[model samples]
Target: MIDWLHPSVLLMLGMLPLIWLRGRARQIWQVTLPAIILGLITTLAAGSQLSLSFMGLELTPLRVDKLSLVFAYVIGIILIIGNIFALQVEDRAQHIAAGLYGASALGVVLAGDLVTLYVFWEIMMIASVWLIWRRKTPIAYEAGMRYLLVHALGGMLLFVGVIGYYLATGSVAFEKIDVDGWAFWLILIAFLINAAVPPLHAWLPDAYPEATVTGTVFLSALTTKTAVYTLMRGYPGLELLLWLGVAMTLYGVIYATLINDIRRLLSYHIISQVGYMVAGVGMGTALALNGTAAHAFTHILYKALLLMGAGAVLQMTGRSRMSDLGGLYRYMPMTFLLYMVGALSISAFPLFSGFVSKTMIVEAAAVDYRGVVYLLMLLAACGTFLSTGLKLPYFTFFGKDSGLRPKEPPINMQIAMGIAAALCFLIGIFPGALYAILPFPVDYNAYTLSHLLKELQLLFFVGLGFVVVIRYAGGKDYIALDVDWLYRGPGRRLVIHTRNMIAEANHDVRAEFMRFLAKLQTRLGKAHLDGSLLRTWATGSMALWTALVLALVLVLTLGT
Candidate 1:
C-alpha cells in the first residue's frame, strides 16, 4: 500500500505541467486533481511507513505516525483550498509552482530520515520562490532574491549539520535530538531561521508580502510551519527555545502594530504567531507539543482565511494600506464578515480556534512555573488583538469611508475563504476533532470560569486601547526597521567597505612588485659594460686556451 501510494503522489508531481494547457477548467483541474489525490493518499496511509536503501543509507520516504498524519492531513486540505482560491489565476506558472510547492511540503513532513527531509526542503524552497517571482514586480523580484538567499543559507547549514551528524552517529534517522555540538547547533539554527525566530526572522516579512496574492496564501501555509514540524521532531524541550519563543512573540507584535500595509502587517504577525508554537516546543511537555501541532494547524487555517480576505480587498481595490482603505463593509459585506471571522479567531475570541489552541501553550508555561513566560504570552495576546484584530479591521472595514467602492471578489475566492473560515470555527468550538490526530492523547479543556474571564478581560482592555491606537496609530504609510537593520544597513555597508579596502591593497602590492622587476631588468641590461676581464679579450683568450690544451695533450703523449 505504501509503495503504491508514494509513487502515485510522485507521479502527480509530473501532472503540474498540464496546467499550461488551454482552458480555465483544464488548468484548475490540473492542480486540484493532484491535491485531491494527495489528500486521499494521506487519509488511506494511516499507520503506514515506506522504507528503502540508497547508497548504503536507509531512507523513510513515507511515515504515517500520528504527528506526521496530522500535518499531512492539514497539508492536503490546504493544497486543495489554496488551488481553489487560485482557480481564477491565469498565470500557469503560479499554478504549477504552487502545486509542486505543496507536494514538497507534504514530502517534508512525511519524511522519516534526514536525507529525505533535506531533499524535500530544498524542493520546497525552490518551488515557492517562483510564486514570488511570478508577481513580476521590482519589489517582488528583489524580495524573491532575498528570500532565496536566506533560505539557501539555512539549507547550507542544514546540509553540513546533517553530514556531520551522520558522521558522528552513523545514522540518518529523523527523531528527537540533543544540543550535541556544532552539528546540532547548525541544524537548530537552520530550523529557527525557517520558524522566523528573531534576528533570523526578517526574511519572512521581507518576502511573503511580496508574493502574488494567490501565491501568498500558499506561502503562508507551508514553509515556516514545516520548520515547526521539523523542530518538534528534532529538538523538543530545549530550554533556550522558551526565551527565544517569548522574544519572537513580542517582537512580532511590536513591529506588526506599527506596519501599515495589511499583508506586511500579517507577515509580521506570522513571526508572532509561530512564536507560540516555538514556545510550546520549548516547554516540551506533552501538552505543549500537542498544542504546538494543533495551533500550527489552526494558525494555517485562520491565517489563510485572513490573507484571503486581505487579498480580496487588494484584488478589488488595487491598494492594501490601512491608511488607504476604510468603510469597505458597505460594498464588500461578505468579505468584511469573512475577514472578521479570521480576525476573531486569531485574536483568540471564545469559541474560536485560537482560543482553544493558544491557551495550551500558556497553560504549559503556567504549569511549568514559567511565570515570566506566562505574562509575556498574555501580553502577546493583547497585542495580537490590538494590531491584527482591531487596528487592521477598523481602518479597512469600518473606520472611515475612503470613497472607493469595489464589488466583492470572485466566487471561487469567497468559497475558499468560507472553507478556511469554517475550519477555523469548527476547530475552535470542537478541538477534540483536531486533537484526535495529535501525536499524543489530549485530555485538557479550554473553557473554565477563570480562564474564560481572564481572556475576555484581557481582550476587552486591549479593545479599549484600540480606540486610542486607531486615532493615532497606522495613520501613515511609513517603514519601520526591525532586526533586519543589522544586515540591510551597517552590515551591508561594512561588506562594501571591506571589498574596497582589499582592492586598494592589491593595487599597491602589484605596483611595488612592478617597480622591483623594472630595476632588476635595468641591472641585467648593463651587465655587458660592467668592466669584467672576459669582456676585454674574449675572442683571443678563447683561441689561445684551445691551442694550449692541444699542445699539452701532444707533449704528454710523447713523454708517455
Candidate 2:
C-alpha cells in the first residue's frame, strides 16, 4: 500500500505549499519551487520500484525501469532548465501551470497501467493548455482552444480504445496489444495525433509559437516526447509506423523549408525529429528501439535548446519571423554560439549527440527495412540538414544581417541555452553514458568510413538540391498546402455557410411565428369584440350543455 504511493506522487503533493506560496515569493522562487519538487521526485524515483493489485487486477502504477527512467530523468532536467529560462517572468499562474505540467508528464512516463497512464495523459493536456494561455493574446487564446479540442479528440479516441481493449482482452495493462483490430488501431491513431503526425500536426506550430517564450521551451519538451514514450511502450513493433514516419519526415522538412517564421520552422522540425524516433520504433529491433529512445532523449535537450535560443531572440527583438530577424550575431554572440551547437547536434555532425543517437535509427533502417525505407530516411536526413541544421541558424544568425541590433537576452535565458548546448556537445562526445540507459544493448559504432561517407554524400547532394531550388524556384509565388488547408479553407467555408443557413432559418422562423401570433390576436379580437361569433357561440354552448346532461343520465341508468 505504501509502495503504491510512489515517490513522484509524494513529491508533487509536497509542491502544494510552494504553489500556494507563489504569490508571496520572488519570481525566481516561484519558478524554482516546481523545479525543486521535480528534482526531488526524480531523485526519489531513482532506485524505488513497486506495484500492487486490487479487486483481482494487477496494478503496476510505478515502474521505474530503464526506459521510463531515461525519459523521467530527461523530463525532470528539462523542467528545471525550463524554470531557469522562465525565472524572470512574474506570472504565478504560468509558474503553477508549468510545474503541474511537468509533474503530469512525469506521472505519464512512470505510469505502469493503462488506466494510470490515461489519467496522467489527460492531466498533461489540461496543464499544457495553460502554458499556451499564458501568452494572453487573442491569437494565443484561439490557438489554445484549437489545441485543447485536438487533444480532447485524442483523449476520446484513446479512451474508446482502452474500453474496447479491456472488453476484448479483459486487461488494462499498458503493454502492446495485437494491432489486428479496431481497438489497437484506435490506440495507434490516438498516439499518432499526439506524435504530431502529419495532417494532424498543425496544433503544434499553431500553439507552440503562440506560447510565451519560456512556455514554448517547456511545451516543446513534454507532449510529443510523452507520445514517443507511449509509442515505445505500447506499439514498438507496428510496421505501419515506418511508412507513416517517412511521410512525417518528408512533410516536416518540406514545410519547414518553406516557412518564413523562425519558430514555425522549429515547430516543423519537431515533427521531423519525432519521425526519426518513430521510424526507429517501427523497426522494432533492439538497436532500433534503443536508438529511438536515445534520439528522443537527446532531441528533447537539443530542441528545447533551439527553442530557448529562438525565445531569447524573440525576447530581445520582439520578432520571430526569419525575414524580420537576422545579423544579431554581433550583439548576441553567446546565444548565436549556443544556437549553433544545437543546430550542429541536430544535424548529426561528428562529435554531437545527434550523431551518436540518430545514426542508430538510420542504420537500423538501412539494415532491416532496406530499399525504399532506407532511401527515404536518407533523403529525410538530408532534408533535416537543409531545413534545420543549416537553414535555421544560417538565416537567423548569418544570413545577410537584417540590420537589427538588439541587446543580448537576459542573463538567465543565456544560462539556460548554454546548459542545453553544453549537454548536446557532451552527449555527442561521449555516447556511452546515454547508451547505457537505452532499453537494449548497443553494439554499433557511429563513426565508420562507410557511414560517414554515406552521410556526407547524402547531405552534400541534398545541400545542392536546396541550392538549386533556391536559385530556380524558391522565390516563386506559390503556397505549399497542408492538411490545415482543409479546415482553414473548406471547413471554414462550410462553417460559415452553416451559420448563414441557420441564421436565415432562424430569421424566417421568428418572422413566421410573429405573423402567426399577430393573425391569432386579430382573429381573437374580431371574434370576441368585433363580430357576432362570440354571442352565437354562447347561445350554442347553452343548448349543447342541456343536451349533454340528458344524454349522460340516460347512459348511466342503462349501464347500471
Candidate 3:
C-alpha cells in the first residue's frame, strides 16, 4: 500500500485540492501550487520505483525505467514551463486542467500494466478536453465535443482489446503481444487513433487551434506522445506501422502546406512528427526503439516551444492566420529567435535536437534496407522542411511587413519560451545527457561528416524546390483540404439531406393519415346521425321474413 504512494501517485492525489480551489479563485497560485508540489515530488523521488497488486494482477503504478523516466522528466519540465507561460491568465480553470493534464500523462508513462495505463489514458483524455473547453468560445465548445467523442471511441476500443487479451491469454500484462490476432489489431487501432495517424487525425487540428494559447501548448505535448509510448511498449515491429507512418507524414505535410492558420499548420505537423516515431518503433531494433523514444522526448520539447512561440504571437497580436500576420520580428525579436531555434530543430538541421534524435530513426530505416520506406521518409523530411520548418516561420515572422506592431508578450511568456529554447539547443549540442536516459545502451554517434553533409544537401534541394514552386507556380492558394473535409463537407451535407427527406416523409405520412381519418369520420357521421342506412336494412329484413312464412305454410298443407 505504501508502495502505491510513489511520487506520481502522491502528486496526483494532491491534485484534489487544486481542483477544488479552481472553483473559488482564478489565480496563478491555483495552478502553480500544484505544480510546485509535483516538482518537489519528482525531484525527491527521482531514483525510486514502486509497484503494487490489484484485482489479482501485479500492477505497477510507478515504474521508473529509463524509457519511462525520460518522458516523465519531460512531462514535469513541460508542466513547469506551461505554468509559466500561462501565469498572466487569471483563469484557475485552465490552471487546474493543466495540472491534471500533466499528472495524467505522467501516470500513463510510468504505469507498468495495461489496466493501469488505461486508467491514466482515459484520465488524460478527460483532462485535455477540459483545457480545450477553457477557451469559452462557441468553436471551442463544438471542437471539445468532437475531441471527447473521438477519444471516447478510442478508449472503448482499447478496453475491448484489453478484455479480449485477458480472455485469450489469461494475463493482463503490458508487454508486446503477438500481432497475429484480432485483439492485437484492436489495440493497435486504438493507439493509432491517438497517435493521429492519417484518417483519425481530424480531431487534432480541429480541436487544438481552438484551445487557449497556453492550453494548446499543454495539449501539444501529451496526447500523441502517450500514444507513442504505448506503441513502443505494445506493438513494436508491427509492419503495418511503417506504411501508416509514411501515410501520416505525407498527409500532414500536404495539409499543412495549404493551411492559412498558423496554429493549425503546427497541429498538422505534430502528426507528421509522430509518424517518424511510429516508423522507428516499427523497425523494432533496439536502436530503432531507442531512437523512437528519444525522438518523442525531443519532439515534445521543440514542438511545445514552437507552439509557445506561436501562442505568444497570438496573445500579443490577437491573430493566428498567416495571411493576417507578417514582419513581427522587428517588434518581437526574442520570440522570433526562439521560434527559429524550434523550427531549425524540427527541420533536423545540424547541431539541433532534431538532428541528433530524428537521424537515428532514418538511419535505422536505411540500415534495414527498406528502400521504399527510406525513400518515402526522406521525401517526408523534405516535405516537413517545406511546410513547417520553412513555411511557418517565414510567413509568420519574416514575410513582407503587414504594418502591425504588437508589443512582446508578458515576461512569463518570454521566460517559458526562453527555457524551452535553451533546452532545444542543450539537447542538440550535448545529446549525451539525453541519451544517457534511453532504455538501451548508447553508442550511436549523431554527428559525422557524411550524415551532416547528406542532411544539408537534402534540405538545400528541398528549399530550392519550394522556391521554384512558389515562383513558377501560378496557383499559390492558401487553402488545402484534409480528411476532415469528408465530415465537414460531404458528410454534413448528406446528413442535412437525409434529415430533410425524413422530415418530408413524416409530413406526408401525417397528412395522409389525417385525410383518411376525415373520410372515415364523414361516413360514420352519415350512418349514425342521419340513420338512412339503418332504416333501409330494417324494411328489407321484414319483407324477406313475410315471404318465407307463406311458403312454409303451403308446404305444410300439401304434406298433410
lDDT comparing candidate 1 with the true structure: 0.87
Residue pairs with backbone overlap in model 2: 352-428, 353-428
- Regions of model 3 farther than 4 Å from truth: 1-3, 19-53, 469-479, 493-560
Tens digits of lDDT, candidate 2, 330-364 = 88889889988888788787788888898888888
Lowest lDDT block of 10, candidate 2: 470-479
lDDT pick, better of 1 and 3: 1
**Best prediction by TM-score:** 1
Name the Cα RMSD for model 2.
8.3
- Residue 494 Cα positional deviation in candidate 2, in Å, after optimal superposition: 1.6
Enumerate clash totals for all models, in the order shown: 0, 2, 0
> Mind giving the per-residue lDDT tens digits that candidate 1 earns over 1-560?
54446633563456555655767756557655756566566555567788899999999888778888777778778887888888888788887788778888888888889999999899899999999999899999988998999999999999999998898888888888653779899899999999999989999998888899999999999999999999999999988998899999999999998898999999999999999999999889999999899989999999999998999999999999989999999999999999988999989999899998998889989988889999999999999988888888889988889998999999989999999999988988898898888888997789888889999999998888877655687547788887777877998899899999999999999999989976766676687545443244677888999999999999999999
Best by lDDT: 1
User: What does candidate 1 score on TM?
Assistant: 0.88
Clashing pairs in 3: none
Task: lDDT for model 3, please.
Answer: 0.83
Cα lDDT computed for each candidate against the true fold = 0.87, 0.81, 0.83
Ranking by TM-score: 1, 2, 3
* Span of 10 residues, lowest total lDDT, candidate 1: 528-537
